[model samples]
Target: MSGLLQGIRIVELASWTYVPSAGAALSDWGAEVVKIEDTRGGDPCRYLTIGGLDPAQSRVDANFMMELGNHGKRSIGVDIKSERGRDILRRLIERADVFLTNWLPAALERADLSVERIREFNPNVIVARGSGQGSRGPERDRGGFDAASYLARGAVAYALTPPDAEYPVTQTPAFGDLQGGITLAGGIAAALFHRATTGHAPVVDSSLLSQGVWAMAPDIAAADYYGIDRIPVGNAGTAPNPAVNRYRTRDGRWIQLVFLQADRYWKGFCERIGRPDMATDERFVPLANLVANKETATAELRHTFAERDLADWQKILADEPGVWATLASPKEVLSDPQVVANGYLMTVTDAAGREYRTAAAPVQFDETPPPPRRAPEYGEHTEDILLELGFDWDAIIAAKEAGAVL
Candidate 1:
């Protein structure tokens, strides 16, 4: 089926994992995404992990970059510092429906690619900006990333580790970056839809800090109501709930059993595990009592869980009313039968004839399923794009020789 964004064109002037991932998601939905990279080094991610290898070959073979953010898009190398490059972008913006970037305010001002400038080129273009904090704030100029956003806005410090643990655990990967990307894509889609009906461009502003706050709204709300400082409970839940903790199985795998309504399912769960007598015990009878003695209840649950393997526990809990459980791991999740049945994994071939698989866009449209297209080669279509922009062949060749295009 054709994609919902089949007719949209996006010019992505963003790099790194965050903003690029947003553009990639749009491309997966059949948008014509042209990722503009500098002719000098292209994206820093291309050479980030390829060490002690030929720069030319390794930079071009940025497998991780391709997997994470370049899928289903074309790449164009241009020296945005040069006049010719800026002119090229201006021409492309005239025909583009969306422009995305994660450059800081100062950087955007320096490049003259600010929202006002872009609007001058294409009045109906949706401009989306993803940043660390926001466009205006005391910390607006401060450098922000997933770590800073997590620490500052997500209240991650409160839940960094178990209260009894010696030290806090730092999260790896760019959670803020990923969340910001997803939020940016959604904002852009909304802006585009609005533009389609109103014939007026809109600015979509998103930040890692805002996204982090959104993810922690539940905890924030709880903290507000109880007037109690939320602390790390580790495997236990924030609320006084004993049934939502993680338990270790016989095979050393952890199973997260989340049964919020223990009063409703405790008896059935006990019968399923051949421990029905425990269901009627005074200490474990009422939900409040169980929560009051959570430590003891957790220990008993852990011991019971350790008596069986994960598969056995899964069998016992499968479709059990009010009891929800799952074995956590990305590897296990990717191979899940439900994921496959829903066509969430897509396979695409690159220019090098290598085939790889990637997850499909999360949102599923009833009438339009997105198509996966190969990412573009570095400046592969530079000449063609410049010519289409009304640049003469002589000027294009001059620009190429001037290191303005690769």
Candidate 2:
């Protein structure tokens, strides 16, 4: 069966994970996405090698990072600074249902590719843009990357770091990029839907900073209403809810329990851990008493959990009434039965006939997902695209010779 966005076409003039990853999502949704890059070095992400993996080890033209961001898109190398290149983009925009870019306002102005100019080519086209910050502000023209704009500026870094740590802990790679890209794709989908019903094209804009703030909106709003500085989470002991805590197993593995309804689950939780005496103990019988002696209770639970391995605890707690899960590493998740059953991971083979597993998009339809496709080589479809744009071989050769396209 076809994806939800089978016939939609997207012209993406963006680079790096922050914006191009949205094209990846669209491609997964079966949109025909054509990624336009400069003829020189192409997307800089092509050289990225994660976890110290050698770039030369990659079977595909791009390393895993580039593939993860740009998969299933047609690649065209065009120097937009040139008149002929700009004309090519205009023609592509004319035929496109959506135009996506991450260019700053100054860069857009310099290239004469503003929203108005883009709409001139196709009045009904949806102009979707990704940015580090909003379009208007003191730093509107400043270029943005996910780390600087999203985590740092949006209060995420401040909130995530442990208060007692000597230094702030680092966030995972592309944490904000993936989220921001997904947000942009969702906005684009909403814009398309709006246009389909109202026949009015709207500009869709998404920014990492905005997304970061939105993700923490509840905490920020609560802080504002309380007229106090945000609280720092130094450790499990500092967590507002004692029921929500992590305990170490005898095997050194960690299990996190989050039973919000503490009163309802207190008896069962204590009984399952073979600590029935603690549940009846006057100091811990009532929820308020337990909270008042949180340290003692947590220490006792930790001691109890340390008496058995994770496997033993898993079996003992399986039928107990509480919300809990083992802390799993990425490798563990790769082999997780639930993830496998849901098809959250997929396999793809590169041109060299090498097979590897990759993540599927965070969506499903009719219990199925789109097959993962490898990213294209640089300018892989330039000739075919030029032909589709009504340029014959002679004309295409001339453009290539003139350095307008690759």
Candidate 3:
């Protein structure tokens, strides 16, 4: 990965998605990230079996899940619990610009890798901590996953789930973790700027809970102001503005119109949809009249849209002032013309040399995204990193023999 942050060095001592995600984003921004993995098999996420994917279902049997947060980092296996391993880490930390971790507070204390100890190795290096709950709460020491802290404690489930439903809707896989990762990446970038300006590095922290709160900030604020949890979810047929709802097409596709200012485009929208009569009809002229007869207006609009497929409607309203978009399915979105034209998605090879499509980080530099490389294999860069750290071949061999490194 090469773009901005080209000379930045990040020592990533974390596993799984939450914090590693920040490292991944930093790597995407052209940072030199060195992932320090444990000696056994590296990050445990490398071997995790997801709920629905089966090895036999695919030809490559590769771990795409692990690749999400790891695709551009170099991996070196070291048993940091050992003295020799800790010594090797110190040497790396001494040269690093950022020390990133997702270890729990208690875990840091137990492993003697606390922030105070880390500062002793490099006073000016930034310490970026990613966690599930937070650093100062009563539950700070308690471990948490995104499901526990983000969806549950952060009120996301409550905000999303219907009151009449038996169970709250669960988040799609790693949604919260990925959001947290991107948020943490932004925080680290800000910390870097702060360091450059003040001559002192500030500790950066972000968490799944923080991200969840941020995601629902608008809803939370509305709730606080109105003294209510939320306004009830409205149905398309009952929408106050017919232009602000979705309608089904002939081929069973759905298209949403987002005309917040309904009156401004009401006539043009009706003309484009081959319903000029409705535009002149007194019952549906102004937005207030349309709302008074919403059920009827919705039915007429749905029937008019059903007369044409998505392709026809696309052309009919392609240049209209009204904002409209097709409700694309997961499969349809991949081949969307906008996605292809903008280079939002890309293909990258994995460690096993299998080519797979992955999404680019949201931001771009010079209208270009960083090219991704495969995540390193376990201990793949052990000798190279050791040599870089000024260790002789003999010393490297000795450390391996003593179980300090893989």
Model 2: per-residue Cα lDDT over 1-406, one tens digit each: 4388998999999988988989998888889999998989788887665675677775654466677678789999998888789888988999999999999988998888888888889999999989999888898888888788988888787777767767765666688998999888899999999999999989998899998899778668868998755654546245555678888999999889898878889988898889999879777767888878878888898899999999999999889778899999988998999998988876778767778776666777788777878888889999999899888999889889989999
Instruction: Give the TM-score of each candidate.
Output: 0.90, 0.95, 0.93
- Per TM-score, the best of the predicted structures is 2
Off by over 4 Å in 1: 50-62, 151-153, 225-227, 231-239, 350-354, 367-369
How do the residues 10-93 of candidate 3 rate in per-residue lDDT, one tens digit apiece?
A: 999998888887888888889999999999888988887778878678656356666778878899999999988999999999
Task: State, as a TM-score between 0 and 1, how close model 3 is to the true structure.
Answer: 0.93
lDDT of each: 0.77, 0.85, 0.85
Model 2, global lDDT: 0.85
Cα deviation at 136, candidate 2, in Å, is 1.3
